[model samples]
Target: MKRFVLLVVVAGLAGGGYYAYRNQRAGTQQAQASAVSGPRAVPVEVASVETMTVNEEVEALGTLAADESVIIASEIAGRVVALGFKEGERVKAGQDLVKLDTAILDAELKQALADLGLARDTNERLRALVQRGSGTQVALDESTARLASSEARVQLAKAKLAQSTIVAPFSGVVGLRSVGIGDYVSVGKPLIVLTSIDPIKVDFRVPEIYLSRVKVGQPVQVRVDAVPDRTFTGQIFAIDPVVDVNGRAIRLRANVPNGDLALKPGLFARLSITVDQRENAMVIPEMAVVPDGVGKMIYVAENGKARRVAVELGKRLPGKVEVVGGLKPGMQIITAGQMRLRDGSTISVKEKPVQTSQL
Candidate 1:
């Protein structure tokens, strides 16, 4: 009887200990489940959408080129006897740039002149003899032919002599010199480069879809990498009628007045052309937009929860973007910490939301 009582007491103690352990484990698991179900709110910066006038613009890359450019070259081969103009100097049209050796040409011209004089004297004597009945008519005609032939030779010599001097074809700045005085050069050899930089041109291409949007006299804004702070404006002076077959793009050209000569040839340019405009368009900061696959999306705050909204985008401006659809005016959108957010996720505004009017 005493042993049975001892076994019962031990069994009662073991059952009580097992029940307590199970209860403790169940309580711990319940606490962990509660913690997981309640998520911490993500902090973010937000901006409100507002109605404003936004420009519909198209952008393209371009290159700046001189209004007129040419490579100065020699027309006739000879020794460079004299350099009339200094390199990198502004020259006027018809100004002498280089003078080739003209000794041989000058002698030839003088000899031709002497021959012409002798022919004229002979022709005069023959006419006098015919008048005096001392020369035949055929002889007089022959002398006249000889006089004409000599005159032709003189003209040819003068033309060859003029070729010895190379003159500037237009008014512009000259480039580096390839030869000095007394340097022998061949015909067609480059002597210098001339470029007219004022009223420079920018060449760019736009998609064929925008062919109708681009036309002559349309305003364009240009910015070059070399001159980042300055914005140059010009009008579309030319547009190619044919679309490029390989790229399906239309070539465009604009002329910008470079009166200060700050822009140069071969500089890369950023071009923007206003194609259309809309009044009272919804706009927000560009950071508020999150690109979705083949589309765009944004996170709007509603009742302390994020609402993923799909938006159709339009003309993009500096620091702001036009919202064409899916977002309304006066809507608050989360701009920062969007990576940690999902639909219906809790959010806390970190800073005062930026007003779209201030954008």
Candidate 2:
């Protein structure tokens, strides 16, 4: 009877152990399901729009050029004898640059002078004879003709002598000399590069859209990277009438006062153009704006929901852009979390106490 009681007690203990193990497994599964189900809150950033004064402008790539630049070449062919100016020196217009070997030309001039003296003496004597009727009219005329011919020969010789010297065509600074002393220079050979740096020019192009804003004497602002912490001013002196078909931009020329020569020709520059004034413009961060097909749009926060609003773009800025339409001031925009939401998508906008000016 004791043995039978022992078997019943052992069976009862085994049954309890099995029941406890099944209950534990069921509780663990129920807890895991509860953790997996819910609307998770996504982290996001937000910003509000504000009215500000925006100056409208167009940007373009431009090259820096002098108002007047040219490569002055030799006009005569001869051995270079004397170099009048050094490389990179400032020279005035009409300054003699190169003097060629003129020994032959000098000899020719002297011979012409001697011939003129003889012709004048013969003409003087012949005129006296004609007055006394001792000479025929033909003889006197022949003497006069000889004097005229001698004078013509003198002029020709002088022209040849002038051809042996080359002078600058304009006042400017000279670049490196391409020819040295004793170098044989042919006609049209480049002698040196001459450029007018003072009152130097900065040639920049403007977009066709702002063609009307640019005119003769329109002021242009220029900044050169070579010289920092300085800004120069120039006036529009010329504007091309035709727009470039490939670039769709207009060519513009501005003459800057480079009195100090702080700005050099061929130096790169950053340009800012101001055409018109605008008031009460709504501006937003560039990151907040998104591109759509054939146009552009941005996301705004309304009623705790993401609303995609179409916006007209104008005067794209470095960090911000001007909203021409489809948005109003004092509206919040989803600057961050674009990947997490879509149009009419619910979002929890956590205003992080950011500055309005930061947008």
Candidate 3:
């Protein structure tokens, strides 16, 4: 009986020892994981904040338009007898572009000239008789009035004759011809679309904060994707009086000389206006900026750790943002791996600094 009791006691003690050993192993594993993850050095990309000059530029999406864009239309009702020019032809002001049937107009003009001659002969004979006291003054005056009326009819006929031919009002490129030969057109009928592309107008908006920086007749720089290799120079042509309620932005227009005609109307353009350019401005890569709830925040490397701090941002350059406040020269900011960081996260920065290229 004693031997059996001793064996049972020994088995119970062995089981308890095994359970305690397993528990200690689990505790040690949890401690190792916690130590590795807690405030440990993490690999990250970083940038430095330095002082220099920055040009305050107002940026917005730009729309291309034409200063003189219109669709040419006919004023008088007539049949299209001829189309003088082909599509995409360069037309000059006063150049005839379309010709209508003028058979009826020519006949009317001839008749008007004959009526004027008959009235003038009658007026001359009456004036001579009145001077000789053979004709009454009233009759002479009535004849003179009749001749004047005939002269007006002749002028009206000439105007109608001019209307038979359609001419361009301004120099422009003619668009697709809406009318063809032998087509009957009514008054105000569209014949073709003409657009003056030279010195094209580029419309863009400026935020109200920089409204005072823009004005009429100011020079600006313009860039377009279609003409990637070229930078076009332009001048500000207009500024809106009212700010857009929703966006709080003011509309502006720039006149770009499209001498090569490389830039077409309706093509999108990215425009930059140099409002204020400083010779030396402090700037940092845009990626270093972390957005907080109210404004922007950034992580500065200090003693091999990331110290997040609030900053006041200013004008943004190619790939950098001008730090107006809360940072000084020679300060390092985490560029990459900023999202997985805290106020005092240990950072293992790469040996080589990141190179910031054109943005």
Q: In model 1, what lDDT does residue 287 have?
A: 90
Residue 95's lDDT in candidate 3: 85
Tens digits of per-residue lDDT for model 1, 39-105: 8899988888978888778989999999999998887788998887877777888999889998888
* C-alpha TM-scores of all predictions: 0.64, 0.60, 0.66
Ranking by TM-score: 3, 1, 2
Error of 3 at 82 (Å): 2.5
Distance (Å) between predicted and true CA of 170, model 2? Answer: 2.1
Clashes of each: 0, 0, 5
lDDT of 3 by residue, 153-254 (tens): 999989878888989989988999878999999989988988899989999987888877777887778888988998888998789898999999898889
Model 2 misplaced stretches (Cα beyond 4 Å)? 1-54, 224-230, 260-264, 278-359
Model 3 pairs in collision: 52-280, 52-281, 52-282, 53-280, 53-281
lDDT of each: 0.90, 0.83, 0.87
Model 1 ranges off by over 4 Å = 1-53, 127-134, 277-359
Please give the distance, in angstroms, between residue 256's alpha carbon in candidate 3 and its true position after superposition: 1.6
Error of model 2, residue 48, in angstroms: 14
- Evaluate model 2: give its lDDT: 0.83
